[model samples]
Target: MFEKKVNIYNVFELRCKTTCYFGVGAIDKMRDISEYLSKRGMKKVIVVTDPVAYKVTGAWDVVTKYFNQFGIEYVLYDKVTPNPTVEQIDEATKLGKEFGAQVVFGIGGGSPIDTAKSVAVLLEYEGKTGAELYEGKFTPEKAKPIIAINTTHGTGTEVDRFAVASILEKEYKPAIAYDCIYPLFSIDDPQLMVTLPYKQTLYTTIDALNHITEASTTLARNPYSILLAKETVRLIATYLPQALSNPNDLNARYWLLYASAIAGISFDNGLLHFTHALEHPLSAVKPDLAHGLGLAMLLPAVVKEIYPFVAEILAEVYEPIVPGLEGKPGEAEKIAKGIEDWLFNMGITEKLESVGFNEGHVEKLTELAMTTPSLGLLLSVAPIKAEKEVIARIYRNSLKRM
Candidate 1:
């Protein structure tokens, strides 16, 4: 659907070197990792997770069984919460160090995996706190190896070098990107996702959709990244509804997981734009809000704000969702409206105000967005060059009741 001709002479660098195992029973590959670790003389591993969800889903039993059979000792650090905080990372890091862990295993959603990334780097730093990492004060030459088992199809933290942690005291969520933090390997098992609640399935799918959309349109877009983005968008548009409607559909679940990984790889190369920059502050301030929900609430407004500059690419993004709209007049508006209608159908019809993001919070959110380090990256890669005023207006627009 993306029919535009790209410049063949453009130079780009891509570095997705993580070995990924993707399928219905990918978790079984833990034996391979166990053997790899045994060869390295690494005996202790720290598993970072959300305890309740892991236990409820039986992923804990499955993972531990594999490790136990391999004679690998592990310490469970299950304090990771949604929108993980600097404090959580610090606590996990302390536990990891105390356990004398040689490897870190992240076994949940983005929050746990991100916490593990910080822990992996902090394990080598000795005295460094997560606050120092959040502030970008220290860069590590090497990090303890990380094994990321993705239980959700969102936030490709499994394959990405980027880790997002919220500093609640500062009311800021800064994304830390370092090469050393990339997972040594990752497993994508759709069996792990069949038990996911429909709401979570919906939200995580939307998050993956945003990743594909943003990655394809950013200034960093290369032919390889765009190829991944287009396929990711197509997969999500086709299979997400099936996964939500029939949670037991393994095929749908498998594709969604694949989409999440490819989108992660795509965005890692192409980067993201204004939607992520805007949503981070919302989650940072609220702490309880899910990242995908914030993106769903804000994406329509962001699409509208940047439409004039990215009409062609936006239309291309929407083609997967609404066929035959790529070359039409007013295609961008059609794309935005299609997304809004899809969200409504998915029961994500609430606005920012429904999530406690009212006009009163606008000024504070705007200030945080303006100050966020990712704002510059977003603006630089955005199809449109947005200023502080434009960012503020987009926030205000998102606050209106749907």
Candidate 2:
């Protein structure tokens, strides 16, 4: 087993900078944003979103109606796509600048919210392109205020200071984790989530589960983060299936939203490990792959690889995820198996091969993973140190169906 002595004098700090308003009718809080913008003398605002889904689901109407009633001048930039690209961020930034937008509102899942974060920052740094931001060549001292309204229960981009942008030219997906990118405020309304498709609900909830699992087992795990992670795991393990079975179950939807937020806060503070490091490259190679699906395919194998080094902590996490499994023999393996079974039951039984990831693609994926800037941070926090070959092996293992 891997072990290290703790230095008692070491110092750490925790800060979740966004103020969150969460509930069923939480969308009503847009009135608060109107007042907030009015106080700041902000007239023009921009709303970033995925045009089709948000429009069909009526989330767009809810936002625009509030802006109109408040007499807030707003422009809609609804070109955001899944795993948003740098070109898309630059395009949205151009629109925000043309409209003289002062505040940004992101009303969807992670892609729109992340695009909004990148746009908000780029707006502050005049003449800087999204590519420059992704390349670390330009850093903004400030970002326009963002109000993140989450319609999905994943990617806690609503509360976190991180935003991921893909650069296809470079074939890389880099996460920008500047403090300035944190949304000024976040709204989590379960009512908006009721419209989410069953597949999305399942995938997003699993994404939240992976966030908690990876965060809890990382080197950065602290008491505060661990408490949040444990509660998040327990809630998702119990409530996710209930919400899936009956999409109209408001209570289950509310808890899933709460768990998603908690998992976001946990991972925001505790960081992540190999699961994310390995998963990012897959999506970078194939932008069409949903992040949660890639995570579902890789997490069990990654956990199994690291189980020997972090068995005790995995056992602790297992108690909440699988009741009555704590302190049992082979608890680490049992926890990993439980997660695999959960993903299988959720209909995410396909391997990387199902997504066109074959053994032939392993080299390219490994190259991308090795070059990712976040990989260094992830590996540092990982329970076991992994070499490039080890990472490649994990990718190969993910190709095998459970």
Candidate 3:
């Protein structure tokens, strides 16, 4: 068991290994990017993405042209969705196998980039689907060389070891093999996210916000992670509204993108919390609501209820951002409440029913959320007891005008 009760005051050891490059037109750096990893007998390549990224980043055309120029044969799989499913992964794996593609390039936002991670693992054992990677059987050796290109500000899932693949209704199981970490490289160019729609601007920022803040207040929270989380929240709070207000402003978009990436790293350093664990099931079922929107709707309630449970951790997390509030009585609560209000202030909060979940589905949804493996990993920290009833409370609190 990785869980151990320890003094929360200890300085925790932080581990991170992904190489990240951030800039305005970093996509143009692709040729150099490809050469650094694609050297030593280039194998058949696959680019996993969606039509939106192809159109938005123009990376598909640009990259395909490069692959062709280098005389390295490649295939394109753009059928990825927001909450990528097993069927999609299976189909993508089949295409990769048919092409004999050994290198997978995930290009776009977290969705396609995340899908690319799942595809690389399952494609190694084509006919087996998510089965091969579900349990202890999956490993780095089973994965093809994967590369990530970021086109959005949310889900630094591009640089992390987590891949969420939906097998059925409102259900996603992560394909987590530690080797899944080395996806060759990640290319982050803020310009790609600049033209993104304002609605995406809002929701994806919510995702980043959850990643940073949740990791900060997570039970096994570390000081370094808390600091990053605080800075991340401040960055998102500072930049998201500006980007929303001015969609074409590259600098605003750049800062927001970097904040998202920082939050992603915070999670990679091991603080993904209950908000993500809960939000996945919401989107896995609704399909219509964007993942970011789902996070927007669910997080604040979790924040309100769970924040007090992890107050000491959260105090450290919020201190760097809110500064003056830590030592004073009631000030920490004030800061935490401010964080929640700021989420609302930035339009990151919404009614769950407005997105999809209604009273009709609450109990079962809550039941599954509590029992799912994701919850086990999350609750291992805080150990949310009165388990079934606590979920009931979360469901009721999440209720909005339907």
Q: Which residue segments of model 3 deviate by more than 4 Å? A: 1-16, 131-141, 169-177, 315-340, 383-386
- Residue 286 shift from truth in candidate 3, angstroms: 0.7
Candidate 2 residue spans exceeding 4 A from truth = 1-15, 323-332
Q: What are the Cα lDDT values of the candidates? A: 0.83, 0.81, 0.69
lDDT of 3 by residue, 234-318 (tens): 6675677789888877767777877787788787775665677677667767766788887767665665566555666566555
TM-score of each: 0.93, 0.92, 0.87
User: How far in Å is the alpha carbon of 19 misplaced in model 2?
Assistant: 1.2
How many collisions between residues are there in candidate 2? 0
lDDT of 2 by residue, 280-394 (tens): 8888888999999999999878877787776766666756555565444355566667767777986788889888989999888888887876566777788777687888888
**lDDT-better candidate, 2 vs 3:** 2
In model 1, how large is the Cα lDDT of residue 398?
80
Candidate 1, residue 116: the lDDT equals 93
lDDT of 1 by residue, 188-280 (tens): 888888899988998998898888778887888887778887788888888888998899888788778878988999899989888998899
Candidate 1 vs candidate 2: the lDDT winner is 1
Candidate with maximal lDDT: 1
